[model samples]
Every structure is written in structure tokens, then in C-alpha cells.
Target: MSLPLTRLLRKLLHVAAKPMRHAQGKDGYVIHAYRGYGSHSEAFLMGRIFRQPGSRSQLAPGAGRDLMDVGRRMLRWGKSGVEVEVALGDNRTTAITDRDGYFSVHLPLDEPLEHQGQWHTARITACPPKQPPVEGEAQVYLPPISTRLGVISDIDDTVMYTGVANKLKMLYRLFIESAERRTAFPGVAALYQALHEGDDGQQQRPLLYVSRGPWSIYEMLEVFFQHNRIPVGPILFLREWGLTLQRPLPRRSEDHKQALIEKMLGLYDEMQFLLIGDSGQHDPEVYAEVVRRYPGRICAIYIRQIGDSDSRKAELDRLGEELAALGCVMLLSTDSLDMAHHAHANGYIDAASVEMVRAEIEHQLADEPA
Candidate 1:
């Protein structure tokens, strides 16, 4: 038979072979497991319900049970939006399935700070088919550093605004497009070069960036930084997992980003930080939690107030107060370069380094033509 015919024949045989076998003896199932990073490194195991020839005998007579013969369980990992599900069974049950035989349900990991900002683990279990189902677990680590004086700002709107994230329509902005159109908000590039370049005799501490943009865009961002003569460190990004009809997405939240910061902190303990973020989502909240948990790991928090919105400013203020209580500076700006200049002039950045960065930013901008 042709390949198409063969596939159709196989599917037909698969269905025909099952007959009307209800969940009797067979008690096995399948699971699609995924782990989120950083504080969300929790695992949620989802399973389905089914019975085989021998299960009927195992079923106790007059046994009270779910009519659809299905049950689901969850585990806590301090992460959010972990969903799981069972294979296709019945419409009566809440379990939805696809032709490939799968299901999903969302479970969240409790916050780690609640437990002294320490680490925690979670496990989930379920039963299903010829083989017995097994339980799975995931771990969550403490948040990244909490205090800092030196700023680690991305060249993009944490400092410069290429206009990817709409100052007018923030909600409509997504990662890919945001990355493409990103230009430096006036003076922002200069500011980065200034602080990163430093004027004093010493080297400035590193400025780390963890972007949701695809790794493929690395060249563009890198060129922009180097062309502008901005000093920076490793630019962390995700490699394209591949295009799917379901819609492309970044790696799990807290997963890729939080992990990157956490690793950087481990590399330098005494170093405090000045975190910079655009008016985009999560950066403020994520930075807030990081500060709350790490305490002295961060020295300052700077959020660029891109578009006109009081809500984000209010949130940064609240977080700033908390940081202030811990003795950290909280700087919010509509422009990145201004903050960059502040970091440089304050003696937070060395004079020699400032000169280098300033030279670069000047050259890049000056060449842009009036």
C-alpha cells in the first residue's frame, strides 16, 4: 500500500483492535512533562484514565468511583501556569484530548520567599495502561541577588527605545517585533557607553542581560552595542526550538531569565546591581521579588518609564521603597541614557571606563547624521 494508505490502515487497525474495551485491567497513561526555570522550576505531572482486560477484577464491587473513571493530581513547585491533562476519554470528564492521545492541566508552585527564600521540591502522581504510571518532581531555587550599585542595562529600552514595545500600545508589543524595531531612546546609547566605559583607573563591574528575544537576533543586538561602543557581557537568549503551528513562544518564564541572573550572581557575590528594565511586563515584578528575597544582592533598581503610564511607576515606587528600606537606590526613567549618565557621574562607575564608553556612544550617535 502507498504511505498514505498504510498510515490510514494502521490507524484503522489501532481503533479496530481496541474494540469496546472499557477501563478494566489496563491501567497505564502518558505524560508530557516540562520544567520552568528560576523560581518557577516546578514540575506538574498530568495523567489520564483507562482500564484493561484485568482491571475489572481489580475493581471492587459497589465501589464508589468517578463515573467517567478518571482522576488527576498536582504537585507544587513555586512556579506558575503548569498545565497537564489525560488522554482522550469522555466528554463528561473535564479532561480534553487530541488525536495523539494527550491532555493538560495547570498547577502552580508556591512562592519560594515564603520558605525563607530557600529552595523547595514538588512531586505529582497518576495511574494509567499496560505499565504503571510514575510520579515526577521539580526543584525551585532561591531568588537572585537583592542589592546592587552598578547597573546592568540592556542596550534596548531598558536604556534605548527602538520603539519595539509601543509607548502607545504596550499590550500589543511582543518579543520578536520588539527586538526588531528597538532603537536607542535618545542619549540612552551614550549613557550605556558612559557607565560601562568608565573614566577612573579601574574596570567597571559586568552588566548582564537576559532577553526573551531569540538567539538568532544576537548578531543585530551585538552589532548595535559594539557599533555604539557600549561595554557589555554575555548576551543570553533562547535558540529557536522551531516554528510550530501552535505559535512560537519563549522558554518558560523564570526559567531562562531567572536562571541566567542566578548564575551571574553566583559568579560574583560581593557585586551589587542596578537592574534596568523597559515598561514591558514582568521585569518590575520579577526585579521586586528578587530584591525582596536576596536583600543585599541588588544595589539599585531603575525602570525606564517608556510610555506614559502611572501604574508601572506606582509599582516601581512601591518596590523602590522596599529597596530603600534595605538601603538600595531605586531609579526610574523615561530614558536609559540619563540613568547611564547618573551611574557614571556618581562614582559608581570608574572614570576611565566612562571615557571609553562615552567615546563609543559618541562615535555611534555622531555618525548617525543630523
Candidate 2:
């Protein structure tokens, strides 16, 4: 009788392991623990299984599976919450959370919404059924990008040359690759300081720094800027999806950047923006596409001539003219300060304010620590 009773109890425990139902939250869906009566049926939320917004969703070898794992735990946070991610399918999208745990994502509506020609919903699974079944759908919409005058700048060679491409060789010098190491173009720091940090009595404007570099470098970058007295602003970063446990989302690098710019444009509709990049790779091409797609939103394009290769410079010059035709200023300068002043005087910023900002930056540059 004792042995029979023990076996029966084991069977009961296995049956209770099943989840009662999934819970729905504000951001996305979540997994929940199964419910049991006269006992603790609280869902420990072991894990989750769902399709990402892609051709294969959770089909990829390492990429999609990791997303599924954390996505489940992300939702299983408290009792009811959403697990958010960039809108699937396209490569460039990223997900972000508002201060209140509310989240939203931006996607290129122009891209194909279907996979293999089949339309699909931005699918997400909910866990631990809510008492009233909360909706986990992301119905929040972002405004368009044509209304703001903003600038998105790069950090590596364009802002500071930390030799990002040769990561293997520069592993030892990572500490030195900071905003302090970020030698400002003669006037660049002043330009950004004035616009973002604000002048004597003027209200500061918003400046967003978007870099392809990892977030790990952000602290050093921040320290460099603060040490140099550069004005601070919202700093966006890619989630730890690739290097860490999180899998690479669709369009991990370039696409993610494009999406971020698009979202920024939508949020600040009336103002145009300035874009700063380098001639090293695809900034010209990328900025060109941005101009073509959202012509009125970009105010200027600044590319640093880090490489002395004539063929590359010529190609960049041609692209600059094309950008100029769209009312965009394309600058290739060795001086950071010159690029900043040029950006300011080209009507991107007020001249007087630029001068003031420039003076302040000069003071910082001169007062280097002993």
C-alpha cells in the first residue's frame, strides 16, 4: 500500500507541472506557471516556445532559439508583463522600453511584411493566463521622421578613432578607446556641446548618438565626453543579443541603425536632422538612401576623410553632390571643429550660438588635465 501510494503521488506531481494558461501583458506575450488547487500551482514559468518575426521565426540554429528562451523569462518577470522585441521580418528594427515598462518598436513599413510571400502577424505568446486576459499586442504607432531637425553621428573614425574594424589587434588598447581619446575635430566638441549642453542662457537641443560599436564601450565613451565636457544626451545601444545570450535580431547592424533613424524622425516630425559619418564604408550609401526615402527630414551629411585614398575620396565627392542636390550638406573634413562649425553655419544651427559653443569647446580643449 505504501509503494502504491508513493507512485500515485509522483504521477500527480507530473500532471501539476503543466502550465494552466499563458498570461498577456502590455508589451508582448509571456509564459506562466500552471495553477493547482489546495496547493501551490504558481507558474514558475520554466520557459517559452514561439516563432520570432522572421522567415523561420525560431528555426535558425543559434539565433532564433536564444530569443525564444529569454523571451519567455522576460515575460515571466512578475506575474503579468510583456516580452518585447523589434518588429520581426526586417533586419534593422530594435525594441525599447519606456520608463513605465511600456515598450514599442519601429519597423520599415516599406519593406515586405510577408515571409515567402505570406503575410503574418507580429506574433508573441502570452503566459499564466490573466484574470481578464490582458492584451499583449503592440498597437502603439510612432509618428513620421520628416518633422525633426536632428543629427545622428557615428563614434569610431567619424567621432573617435578607436580602430573598431581591427578588434582582434586593439583588444589590449580598449581602455584607451574612450571619449577622452575622442580627439575632437577642431570645433566638433563645441558644436555638439552648444547644441546638446546648451549655452549661457539658451535652451539645449536634442542630439542622439548612434554607433555600431557595442554597449560595453559606452561607459568609456561617456567618461570621455564628460571628461571633455561634451553635453550629454540620449545614448542608444544595441541589446546584448549577439555577443551575449541574446541572438542577433534581423538586420543586426546596418538595418538596426536605419530603423533607429527612422523612428527618431517620426518622433520629432517638424525638425530636420544632420548625419555625420566617415567615407570608410557605407555611410554615404546609407545616408543617400535615407535622403531618398525621407528627403525632407535630413538637414546635412558630414563624412570624415579618414582614408587618403583618392579613388574613395572621388566617389565620396560625387555622393556629396547628390546629397547637396537634396538640400543636404555633405562635408569631408579632417578637423572635428571645422565639421561642427560648418554644420552650424550651413543653417543647421544658429551662427551666434555656434560661436558661443565653439568658444566654450576651445576653453575645454585648452584646459587639458596635467
Best by lDDT: 2
Model 1, span 29-76: residue lDDT tens: 423232222323222223322222223433433212221122211110
lDDT per residue as tens, model 2, 46-115: 1222222212243443433444433543333333144433333342243333222333333444454333
| Structural similarity to truth (TM-score) of each candidate | 0.47, 0.53
- Estimate every model's Cα lDDT from 0 to 1: 0.45, 0.49
Worst 10 contiguous positions by lDDT, candidate 1: 72-81
**Stretches of model 1 off by over 4 angstroms after superposition:** 1-151, 163-182, 199-201, 239-249, 252-255, 344-346, 350-370
Q: Residue 86 in model 1: shift from native, Å? A: 43
Off by over 4 Å in 2: 1-148, 163-186, 197-203, 243-252, 350-370
lDDT of 2 at 31: 25
